[model samples]
Structures are given as structure tokens and as C-alpha cells.
Target: MTKRNKLVFAICAVIIGIIAGMVFVFFNQEDLINEDEAKAIVTERYGGSVEAVEEGADDDIYIVNVEGDTGTHKITINRHDSSVEAIETIAKPSEDTAADDSNTSQEQNEGTENDEPSEPEKTEDESDTAPSKKEEPAESNEPEILTVEQAENAAANEVGGNNVYSTWSGEGQNREYYILQIVDGDDEGALVSLNGVTGQVNKVVYLDVSDDDYGNIEQLIYEANTYADMVDGRYIEFDDEYFDEEEDDDYEDDED
Candidate 1:
């Protein structure tokens, strides 16, 4: 062949090779596990009812929604390997209702008990010419903020985690509190926020370490620290209607 024809032939051979490699990859790529398989894997691992399973942002990932006894969880699964990537807690069972019921019962029991009023007392020197003295005002009653250890304990009580990976204690915009990173094993964990004054749980958010590069423990602790720095120790009830109000208004405007 002539030099020019030989060069063209070489170029065409390289292009064909590239096209063949692409075809092989497109046909032989690893197959992803189905939605039912993903649900079974999550249900077996997390011991919850799999409410729904949806495709994730990536083609090889699945997001499984589960409702456990303690809370609702959003579990991420790697469909190719059938591995759990992350578990995010969307909701925890409310303790306020139970607390209120107990308080009411205690108040009712106390109300049934009768108390006797004390009689007035007179001193022997009441008639004496002693000068009357001004009484000092009562000391101010204030709630005491809990220590770091107490805050950690409070968090542990709310979430049944055997290990506390990390703890951050500081005063936020509204109150003083502690945020703790807790985990059961390598995969499951939570970031717990405890009230410093009341020793009550403020929030319990599940850890999502799917994108963590440093490892689960390190990333979880880092997340706890970041959350502690940003939390203002304020609890606000989340309502879906609140978010849709603007959308509803726009729809009404369109009708008019």
C-alpha cells in the first residue's frame, strides 16, 4: 500500500477498536439488583417494614423507605452489590404525648390528697419593744444547664446506641445543649441533640455516610460537630401544608 493509504487504514483500525470496546461495555456492564431484592435486603438488615423503594440519583443505587417501631428510616442501597450505603431517619416517635399523659396522671393523683393548713403562731416576745427588720428577697429560681456527661447520657437514653462516637457541647443561639454522634455498628447511627437545661432530647437525626471518604466513624463525628455548630437549640414542628401555602395561593390566582 502507498504511505497515504497505509495511514488512513491505521486510523480506521483505531476507530474500529474504540467502537468495539464501547459496544462490549454497553452490553456486559454489571446488572443492578431489582427493587424487590433491595427491599428484602433492607428489611432483613434494618428489621423494618419496607414501605416503598425508589431509584436513586445514580442508576446503581436504590432509596428504600421503611417504617420501624421507633422511627421512619430512608435507607440507601447499592443495587450492584446489595450493600447498605446510608440510613437517614426522617421521623422519630413523639415522646411528648406520653409525657403529657404521665404528667396528667401524676397531677390527678396529687389532687386527691388533702393538706391541712397551719395555725398562726405568736412569739413570747411579741409585746416586747424590738425593732422590726426588713426581710431579704427570695433568691432567683433558674434552671441549671446539664454537664457534657449528662447531655451524652440524655442522648443515649433517647436512642439505643451502644456506642457514642463523639460529643459536642456548647451554647447555641437559643439554649445550651450537646450534640452526640452515636452508632450501633459500622453502618447504623444517629446524631442526637439534647437540651442542656431540661436534659430532654431535642432531635435525633440519622447519619448519612454514603458519600463519606474518611470512613463512617470519622465522617459521623464531623457531621455531629457541624450540626452542633449550626443548631440553635430551637424545636419547630414541620408541616407539609406550610410549604404548600405559596403554591396554593398561586393556583387560586390562576383560577381568578
Candidate 2:
């Protein structure tokens, strides 16, 4: 063969090899994830609508796009096994006006107090409960117990509420004893930990309530359904409820 012809053939071979490599990478990538799992994972992580953007081959990966308040996320998954390979996020304007609504709700809640005398008295009663040792778990490693006054102050700072009832105490996995309870009607109280020797509220969760028995699971389900409709799918579950007589009795004993 002529030198020029041979050179041309070699160049063509190199180009073909490169093309083949790319094809292999694109086609032989990995496992396959079904549409349902992809959607569920995306929704849980990003809290939005997840739509399939691209499908993958038998051994290739699928790509999905999740739309959320902040932006859009591109998630790649293995086709054969349905595991996530990569995720890319793109910023976009928020779709839900939750922030604005939350602020308005807070303002309304604050303003309504001025029109009612019973509300202030109720708040005072709730706050006076104070942190009690009975709520502490038997195996707790609480270094120091917080005084009722200190607990009240901590709760107030965390959520602008004067009635911060200290309900339960236990050693959290983080090497701190957590004081847990309900605060405000819609808010979860907090988990305050104190220094070994200081009676102080070390940590606070403005809205952190634990799951209750949700008595008559059927009732809970009905309530959840009603709430879902009321909120128009904006909220899926009811995290708070009116204290049951039994629960109140339990609380009274604990308080004592």
C-alpha cells in the first residue's frame, strides 16, 4: 500500500476505536431502576415531582428529572440494578409559596392573642408545667437536670412561646440527654440537653414532637385522609393531635 493510503487507514482505525469505546460506555453502564422506585426516591429526597427524562438500555442507566421549589434535579440510575449513579441539580424559581404562607400564619397567630384573654391564661398554664425528672428515661445519662425556669427560658427563645412544657428526657445517641415535649399547638417542642453540672437547656427543637400511639389506627387513618383533603395534598400526615384523656392522665402522673 502507498504510505499516504496506509496513514489514512491508521487514522480511520483510531477514530473507529474511539467511537466504539464511547458506545460501550453508553450501552454497558449498569442496572435498571423501574419507574416507581425512581419516582419515590426522588420525591423523598427532593420533595417534588419526578419525571423520567431518558431511558437506558438493558445494562445502561436511566435518567430522571425532579422538579422542586428550589430547582430541577437530574438523577441518573443504573438500568440493570436500578441504583443511582449520579445526580445533578439546576436552580429554578420556587413553585410553592410555603415561606410566605408560613410567615403569614405566624403573624396571624401572634395577632389573634391580643383579642382573647383566655389564650394568655392558657399559655401561662402550659408554661408552668416545667421540666420534671419523672419524664427522664430510667437509663438516661443526663449530666445535669435543668431547672423549670431555665427550661422555660430556653423554650421561649426557641419558639417565641412562653408555654414550653418539658415532657420527656433521655440520652440521645449523640451523647446528650434530650428533653422532649410538645410546644405550641402545631409545633414540636424540643430536645434540650444540659451540661453535666449546669441546669440549662442546651439544645432546642422548635418543632420536634414524637409519634404518639395514634389510638384506633383506623381513626388516625381517617384523620389523615381528612387532613390530606383539607390541605389539598399539601400535607400528607397529621403530626399533632388533641391530648387524649389517658395521655393527660399519664402526663399528670409524670408531672407529679
Per-residue lDDT tens digits of candidate 1, residues 92-187? 857885677689989887777635455667676864655778899988676566767777677777776654454454554345454544355554
lDDT of 1 at 40: 85
Considering every candidate listed, which one attains the maximal TM-score?
1
Per-candidate local distance difference test: 0.68, 0.55
On residues 1-256, what C-alpha lDDT tens digit does candidate 2 reach at each position?
9999999999999999999999887665433455676677667766888755667555365678887666778888765665678978876656357677678899999999876776334466677875656665578574555555565555456545445233333433223233334545644443343332344444443333334522343343333334434543321334445335557899899999
Count of steric clashes across candidates, in order: 0, 9
For model 1, name the residue pairs that clash.
Answer: none
**In model 1, where do residues sit more than 4 Å from their true spots?**
1-28, 94-256
Q: For each candidate, what TM-score against the reference? A: 0.29, 0.28
Q: Largest lDDT belongs to which candidate? A: 1
